[model samples]
Target: MAINSGSDPMRFSASIKVVLKDGVLDPQGETIGRALKDLGFESIVSASSGRIFRLDIDAETEAQARKIAGEAASKLLANPVIERYEVEMAK
Candidate 1:
């Protein structure tokens, strides 16, 4: 049997962007925005599609946390060929 307890000590949060590179165009975002406008969603001034992830880590130091985050971004989060990452740590 598995317990349903939700208590945990690790805490982390990340804001990730998988945008088109400087020379690339984001057709998906543009298309979505246009669709929204067509649907009478005038309140949406602008739209950009991206991903956000929340993680829980065991790192006790900022350096360790950054290292872990960098690994995650490189491995799964951002496409290295067309994207870059910026990591910020909570104090």
Candidate 2:
């Protein structure tokens, strides 16, 4: 939980990362990997594409905030079939 100085609700920020599941094709990541190799980055064998969503939420506790963010991600941010998502509190 967070302690507020006044009557305002406790607010927290969350970051959600959405990525394609393994065995799923990632064309954008492949393109970037090729481009990096062209630039003499041989050690970079592969790349994965993903989306980061930063959200500010007003809640009573950190757990509640995380739950809200996770719910949002599951409902709209990531596709359950081919994509997976992770939610964490933003520093």
Candidate 3:
């Protein structure tokens, strides 16, 4: 949790990194990387794709912001069995 003080209402931005759980194959990322190589884009050696979500929320406190973001992750952003999520918040 973070605390911010100023005249303006506090704003929190969250960055979420969603990745395939260890042992889960990222075939889509691999396939895209392979395709890029085939098309002569040799600069791309590998691809590990993931999802990112940027959110804007208003909360009286940073703890509340974190709690809300956590609930969102558990309910919608992440697949419990095959995906894991990391959350970062800025104020």
Candidate 4:
């Protein structure tokens, strides 16, 4: 394939993982664990809530795509005080 121009948009795929920070209470996770135990899931012990987002971005470069996704995560996808996020980008 021919190389794309600097201005040409390239397709990039990204996966973002957002989770609550340590020492934070996750009532929903605890509830899920309780429900699982009630359902005879003996191995169920602890649970934690987290979110993953898959995004397809059109940007000039992989770095740009990563920056965009990171900015989104920092601004909206996760809370700086209570949550942490990881962004992985691929072409």
Clashing pairs in 1: none
* Residue 85 Cα positional deviation in candidate 2, in Å, after optimal superposition: 0.5
Candidate 1 stretches greater than 4 Å from native: 1-15, 43-45
Compose the digit string of candidate 3's lDDT tens values, residues 1-91. 4565553656788877888988799999999999999999999888888898887877777777878888898899999899999888975
TM-score against truth, every candidate: 0.66, 0.87, 0.78, 0.86
Off by over 4 Å in 3: 1-9
Off by over 4 Å in 4: 1-6
lDDT of 4 by residue, 25-87 (tens): 999899999999999998978988899998899988899999999999999899999999999
Query: Model-by-model lDDT, in order?
Result: 0.69, 0.92, 0.84, 0.90
Per-residue lDDT of model 1, residues 1-91, tens digit only? 4474454435555444455566556777789999999999999986667665655566545577777887897899888887776666655
TM-score of 2: 0.87
Which clashing pairs does model 4 show? none
TM-score for predicted model 3 compared with the true structure = 0.78
lDDT of 4 at 5: 50
**Shift in Å, residue 51, candidate 2:** 0.4
Count of residue pairs whose backbone atoms collide, per candidate: 0, 0, 0, 0
